[model samples]
Every structure is written in structure tokens, then in C-alpha cells.
Target: MMTDLVTSQPAMRRLRLSPTLSKYIARQYLSWFCSFFFAIVAIIYLATIVDLLDRLATKDVSLGITLNMAFLKLPYLSQEVMPFTILFAAMATFWRLTRSHELVVARAAGVSVWQFLLPVLASSVVLGALAVCALNPLSSVLLSRYERLEANYVRNQASMLAVSETGLWLRQADESGQSVIHAESIKPGSVALQQVMVFRYAEQDRFVDRIDAREAQLQSGRWLLFDAWLARPGVPSEFHEQLALPTDLTADNIQDSFAPPETISFWNLPGFISLMQAAGFSATPHRLQFHRLLALPMLFAAMVLLAATFSLRPQRRGRVGVVILAGMLTGFLLYFLSNFVFAIGLSGTIPVVLAAWAPAGVSLMLGVAMLLHLEDG
Candidate 1:
């Protein structure tokens, strides 16, 4: 009877603490996360407003519009700092538990490290998924709208480029009034357009002529059109095997003119990448972005693991301030390293998948190594 009672008591105690501990840790982590997230959002919003006010002050942009732009940008900015938020949240949660001697008590009472860390880790995973699946789409939409509003009202400019399953449309102006070019597709890394149509305008925005070409390649100072058809207002259309269309536009300008990959939603990226690829445009940027977002959940979980590695130890074991500073420094290094590798990926120096995932992979391994050493070695 005594053995049964004793075992029953311990089992019941574990059953009680399991859920309670998870709830406590989850709540603590969430509190810190929200506090950190909102604080960062507020910081970004304020900074955005200041820049807007400075740039748009004399551009006929109203105070309301400026505030709206700032607010619209917050969602996208929030994503940029999410990993940091997770890191700070984990550190704060563990630090508080350690300072209050709660963690020490839990460890002494036979609570395994993973047992207490599970809630925070799970939270990190969920938050990362939500960031990709929910926040990302919302941010992408709002950012597009914001860019449109900024271009129309503040910049007084036309949309740079429009791409779809059908084709690509580009608009540019020079000493000659303007031109709208449509192409069924493009050849990657070169300004070579297939099934191209160019609508030309003369000075005073007069409809001057139209040229249709089976193919066109942009060279030093002019477009080399192949199998071209030239049509004019009153003159008969003429066909030629080759033609030179003078232009001020360059490969750099055309490449720079595409909408940044950041503006595309996660759900739309795969389709967009396909379209770009079929159109013979390099989709490296979009591919990199897609991989980066896909890796985000794992990266966030790694952040939590790394934080726990640095902050879970009792403060009495080391100088608390120094330990925290070291942890933060490590986080900073990770951030810069991620940026550096991502840039390399963008430049095609390495595979996009590797660039996007390397930081998270390294962080996860480092954390697991530290935990093994602490718990088992």
C-alpha cells in the first residue's frame, strides 16, 4: 500500500506539473514575444513616418497619407525582425525563470530540460509558420498597395513593369515621347525578347508607329530586331529580316526595372517563379526568397534553441550580464552572416537553398551540440 501510494503521488505530481509547466512557459514566452514585436513595430513605424514626412513634406502628400503609408509598411517590417523577436523573447523568458530560481527548482525536481523548453520551442515553430502563411501574404499585399500609392501620388511615376502568365510589359521614355514594349517571353541574362511588339510615340505624345518582331535583342545602343514588321499611320507596313531600333535603355535599366521579389506573396511565388522561368528570365531572386521564407519556421525554432543554450543556465554559474551580452552578440553575428550569404545567393555565387538555410542549420547544430554537452557529457 505504501509503495503504491508513493508511486501514485509522484505520478500525479508529474501529471500536474507537465501541463502547468507548459502553460507557464508558453505564457511567459508569448508575453515577451508580443512585448518585443510591438516595440519593434513601433520603432519601425516611427522611423518610417519621419522619413516620409521629410521626403513628402513638399510633395503634396498629406499627413493622413503619410501616416497610412507608415502603417501599411509595418506588417512587412515586422517580418524582418521576427527572428530577433524570438531570440529576445526566449532569452527573456529563460532569464526570468533563472533569476527567480524557478528553472533551478524545475531542474532539481526532475523536469528534463526538453520538457520545459518544449512550449517555447513549439511557440517558435507556430509563429514562424504564421509569419510565412499569414503575415507574409498580408504584408505583400499591403506593400504593393503602398508602392502604388507612393508612385502615383508622391513620385508621379508610372508602374515600372507588369508581368503575367501572358507576357511582360515594360514602359520607358526618352527624347522620343515614350514606348510600350510587350514580349511573350525573355531569354535569361540577356535583354532578348521573343514575339515582341513595340508601340512608339513621337514628340508631343503622337502615335508615330508600331513595330512587331519575332525576336529582339538589346545591344550597346539599340535594339537588334529580327524578322521585323514596321507599320506607320499612313505608310504601308514593311517587313525586314533585321532592323536597328535606337534606344537609351540598357540591360541594367531593364533588369533594375522589374518589381522586387519582396512584393510577391508566398502563395504567388511558385507561380511567379514558373512564369519567370518559362519566360526565360532568371528567377534566382524569387527562388531565394521562396527558400528563405520556407526555412523561416526552422530558423525561428533554431533561434529559440540558441537562446536556451545561452540563457538556460543558472545565473550563479556565471556573470548574468556577460552571458546575456555574449548571447546577443552571437545573435548579431548570425544576422549579418545570414545577410552576407543571402547576398551571395542573390549573386549566384551559391545555391539559393543553401544560402537561405545555412544560418538556421548552423544555429540548430550549435544549440544541439551545447545541449548535449551540458546534459550528457
Candidate 2:
């Protein structure tokens, strides 16, 4: 009996696939899915662009600048709609599988549901990572360009930037002196003035002295004016004097005179925050934006999970229209809640980090719970 059993036990074999077959299947699936996704995205994108153009046209925006601004805005629009595209694609794919009973056949062939989900999970991860790293950089560049274009053609305003080649000129006034500073440049968080000149006026607009310097830098809380020359009002025509001039303004004061942080990119948030603090300005919004950027991937994952929970239920006996409506309602509610939390976060009622992450965290937990209940329990 033992010898018979040993002879009956054949060697286990592994299944193999031909490279050509594998490539063909991959190409087919990619072609089908990409076609479907792009079609939907194109329709939505075009509608949005048309509406924006119509609104701007009424405001006297030139056609060329309007087109440029709209194209520059495409990256942000794509980012905003990508999660919805993922949801629709997943729903359509599963619906097709169910309608044709392909899912049934796969299950009959011993393919687990988890096994079927592996490809989707992998794709979602790759897309999420790309949205953060590659897409964000492109969006930042386009956004900067769009702002400049808008200022030039659409809006009659200019955004002041910090650096300039002609040097930094600022008006300063106090009880002791009224001074206008002309320096080669002003560093963000440090006072390093080059080719400095200070024109001083005495009480009742009397000329006091003019001080010129080769270089000046901020140390501690004062500006150490250096390599200086002083010309007093009563000096002889052939003679000029040299003297050291001191200032109480520091690097922090300079930075406080600029615009807010909403215009900066995610990549520059950390450095900007440090500079803002060094310049004695509140960096709360910048810190919040940093946390919000960090939470985007989790938020996107939660969106997918929420979509699956509502749309992936067994529909053999249920109304398909009702299911679709339910999915739409769920998506809308999630969107509303996320925006509400973001508004609260921006209002400073809660801590910046907590406010930025709370919506994503809650949505993820709710999605996971619903999925586990439906799929496992």
C-alpha cells in the first residue's frame, strides 16, 4: 500500500505564461482602461474650460491671455478631478465584469477577490505617488506662470517679489530720523545690505547728513553699517568726513513688510516657515499647508476606499439605479465634510496639523469599517 501511494504521488508543477501572451493581455487592458478614463476626463475638462472662458470674457480678458491662463490651470484641474476619475473607472470596470459574469468565472477558477484587487491597489499607489512628486512640480510651475499672465492681461495688479537686481529701496521713518535705505539686496531672514546709503533729515526737513557704505549686515538686533562715508550739510566743498552709522531695524522687520504665505508652493513651505519665524511673522498658515500636503495621499486613498464600499456590493437582486444614486450621495457627503473641516482648520479654531488631517483620518476609518462589514462580516 505504501509503495502504491508513493507511485501515485506525482511531482507538483508550476504554471507558466508565454511572454507574448502576457504582453498582449497587458496591452489590451491598458488600452481599454486608458481610453475610457481619458474620454471622461476630456469631457469634464472641456466643460470646465468653456465655463471659465465665458466668465472671464465678460470681464474684458483678452482671448490670448485667457487661453494661456486656462492652459496653465489645467494641472490643478487635473489634480482635483483625478480621484473622481479613479472612482468612475473602478465602478465601470467592476460593472462590466459583473454584467458579463467574468468575475464569476474568475472566482470559479479559484481566484480570490483579494487577488483580483492586487493590480488595482498597485496602480492606485503608483498614481498617488506620481500626483505628489511629479504632478505637484508641474502644477507649481504652471500656477506661477498663470499668476504672472493674469497680472499682465486679466488683472490690473502686481505681486511684489522679494529679490531684485536694482537693489532694495524702502521708506523708513521715526522720531529721531527719517531715512530711505538703498541697499544692493535684502536677504529673507538676515540683514545683509550691500552698497548701502542713508539720507537723513533733521527736524522741520533740515538736511542733516548723507551716509554711504560699501556693505552693511544685520547682527543681533541692529544693522552694523560698514565702510562708511558721511557728508554733513555744512561741510567744506573740498572736504568730506567718514563716520559709523547704526540702525535698530533687523532682518525680522524686513520680512514682515511683505505679502502672506498662500501664494507659496508646497516645496518651499518648510524654508518659508523658518524664514517667517526668523522675520517675526506668524507662520501658522504655512505650517497648516505643509500638513495638508502631507495628508493628500491618505485622503485620496480614503476616496477610493469610500467609492469601493458604496459601489462594490452584490447587485444580483438590488436595483442598479438605486445603487448608483447611493454612491453619488456618499461621494457628495464625503466631499462636503472634507471641505467643512478644511474651512475650520483655516479659521484657527483648532491646531493646524490636527485640522488638516482630521477629515482624511475620519473618512479613512469610516471607509475601512464599512468595507469590512460588507465584505467580511
Candidate 3:
């Protein structure tokens, strides 16, 4: 009777102390979480710098430009790498706890596994929010700078504003009229024409004239067309005549005619879409990208949940290696599935918003289910 009473007293003491122990575990987990997070970021940054140096070695870009480009590229890479970093950090934290037998002790103290996971989940939520609100804007700025630097220094080929398998197309306008130009191929600053056609329309919505050029070169705010044929669209079809054409339109002017979708930022996406549509350009892809950005926070949170689900199991089962592998595989599968959905969305097979958010939603559900099963079972 005396021994049984002594054993019961210790059990009562542990039950009373469980909350304090759980809180202590939470603090330790957060400390490890932060340390691992920053370490991973540093390692990724160093690897990126090394790779950038190798690529820039053959180029004549200035050091300042190279450094600027590298900084700009970091935000984009951070977004890509951060989710996985969260996973690895969680794995490391849990593994360390398991190795030290702290987890076992906590479990034995009547502290449920879910009690210990609260801190990790909180940290994940905080990180996901930071990535979306703070890091996203920075990424937008850097990406823009990186693109500009690439266009200025690394791109040797005459930049193409638009291309199709059918042919190249551009919109050019001047004081006289607006023109739609189509050609087989454009060589940098020059328009190379196997078949070239230009439609000239008047401001009054009248048919003005058409020009067919064999070849054209943009020079000094003007276009010089050789072996050109002129026709008045409003006049007789038989009135076509061969001639040389000259117009005030240069490569810079042509470049200004069409804008790339990536140049727009998340904040400006709605306004930009309205502006693009008003200016008569399709804004489908830009709209899609905008929705995807909005979904990113949820995606990041889901990534954390997925990682925790795969790696938070008991270590005594001797399946640590399998758990790590499963975490990696889950991350990869989620990535590919998100991309596939995005592609389908872009192709108009699915709603853009649905495509963007569905993967994150699905993963989150799966993670929650796994957590409930493991914790309760």
C-alpha cells in the first residue's frame, strides 16, 4: 500500500508539471526553428552567388550591375526556397528533440504530441505571412531590376517584343497613322521579311493604305523599307504599285509598342490589367499571375503543414530516414501538381483562382488529416 501510494504521488506531480514542460519545449523549438531558418537562407544565398559568378565570368558586366542583379535575384529564389527551408528546419528541430530524448520525456509526462506542435505551427504561420507581405514586394522590385540588367548586358540578339510560330508581329504608330506589322522573322534592329505585311489605318477608322515590304531596317527614329509595294485599301485592288517606303519608327519605338507581362507588380496588377485591356492587349496571363501571388501565403502555410505531417512522427520507430524521404517527395509532388494546375489554368481549362489555391487547400487538408490520425492513433 505504501509503495503504490509513492508511485501515484510521482504520477500526480508529473501530470501537474506537464503544461510547464510543454511550454519549455515550445520555446526550445522556436529557438531551433529560427537558427535553422537563417542558416538555410545563408547557404542558399552562397550557392546562388557562386552560380551567378560562373555565369557572369564570360560577360563584360560591371561589378555594380552584377551585384545589383544578384540582390534582385535573391527575392525570387527566396520564395522558391523558403517553403523547403521551413520543412528542413522542422525536421531538424524534431530530430534533435528526438535524439536528445526530450520528446520521449515530454510524451511520458502526459503532454500530448499536439501540445508540443503548437509552437511549430505558430512559427510557420508567422513565417508564411512575412514571406507574402514583406518579401513579395521586395521580390517584385528585384525581379524587375534583374530583367533590365539581363536585357542591357547579357542579351546579344536583337530583343523580340513578340513572336509566334506563324510569324513575328508588332504594332507601330506615328503622327500619320497606326499600323499592324507582320513578318516571317525580325533580326534584332532589322525586320527580315520572307513575307511582310503592314496595315495602315486612319484615326477616323478609314482604310488608308497597305505596305508590303521585302525587308526593313529601323534607323534614327525611322524605318527604311526596300522593295516595298504600296496599295490603297479603299481604292482598287489592281492599284498596287512597287515603291521604296520611309517612316519615322525606330527599334526603341517598336520596343515601346509592346510590354511584357512580368514587368507588372502584384500591387499594380489590377490597375495594369485594366490599362492593358484599354490599350487593346490581352491581359489573361497577367491576371493569372496576379491570382497566383495572392495565393502564395496559403501555399507557404500548406508547405509547412505538409512538412510537419511527414516528419513529426515518433523517432523510436526507427523510420527517420523514411520520414525525411517522404517529406522531400511530398514537397516535389506538391510543386509539380501546382505547376500542372497553373498550366491548365493558363490554358483556360480551369479557373485561374481555383488553379492557384486548390493545391494549397488540398495539401493543407491532407496535412491536417495526417496530424489528427497520428496524434489520436
Evaluated with TM-score, which candidate comes out highest? 1
User: Which parts of model 3 have CA positions greater than 4 angstroms off?
Assistant: 1-30, 105-111, 156-264
Candidate 1, residue 7: how far the Cα is off, in Å:
6.0
Mark the regions of model 1 whose C-alpha exceeds 4 Å error after superposition.
1-17, 150-157, 202-206
Worst ten-residue run, lDDT, model 1? 11-20
Per-residue CA lDDT of model 3 for 1-377, tens digit only, reads 99999989877766553556656755765676678667766776778667777777899867776767777777777777776776677777777777788878877887666667766766677777777667776787778777767776676423334545556576655677677777776553234344678788879756687778777655565556667777784665432334444465555545453445454567777876675554334556778878777776666667666766766666556688888888888888888888899889877888878887788789878877887887888
lDDT per residue (tens digit) for residues 1-377 in model 2: 99877755532111222344334333433454577557865775677568668767657677666666777877766766666666565555555566667656655555555445445545655666777677766877787777676666556545432433355565555677666667765444446666788788767877687778876666664456766777776784322233344555555555554444434667776877776555344567678867876777777667666766755555856687777677767767777877777778777788888988898788779877887787675
- lDDT of candidate 1 at residue 81, scale 0 to 100: 91
Model 2 regions lying over 4 Å from their true place: 1-61, 108-112, 161-263, 316-318
Per-model root-mean-square deviation over C-alphas: 2.8, 8.5, 10.1
Writing each residue's lDDT as its tens digit, candidate 1 over 1-377 gives 99999988885676344777889999999999999999988999999999999988788778999999998888999999999999999999999998898988887787878888889999999999999999999999999888888888777875757788889988778776888889999887778999999999988778999999999998888889999999999899999999998777787767766667778899999999998888888889999999999999989988998898889887665588888898888888999999999999999999999999898898888888888788784
lDDT score, candidate 2, position 358: 90
TM-score per candidate, in order?
0.91, 0.65, 0.65
**1 or 2, greater by lDDT:** 1
lDDT for position 64 in model 1: 96
Clash pairs for candidate 3: 158-188
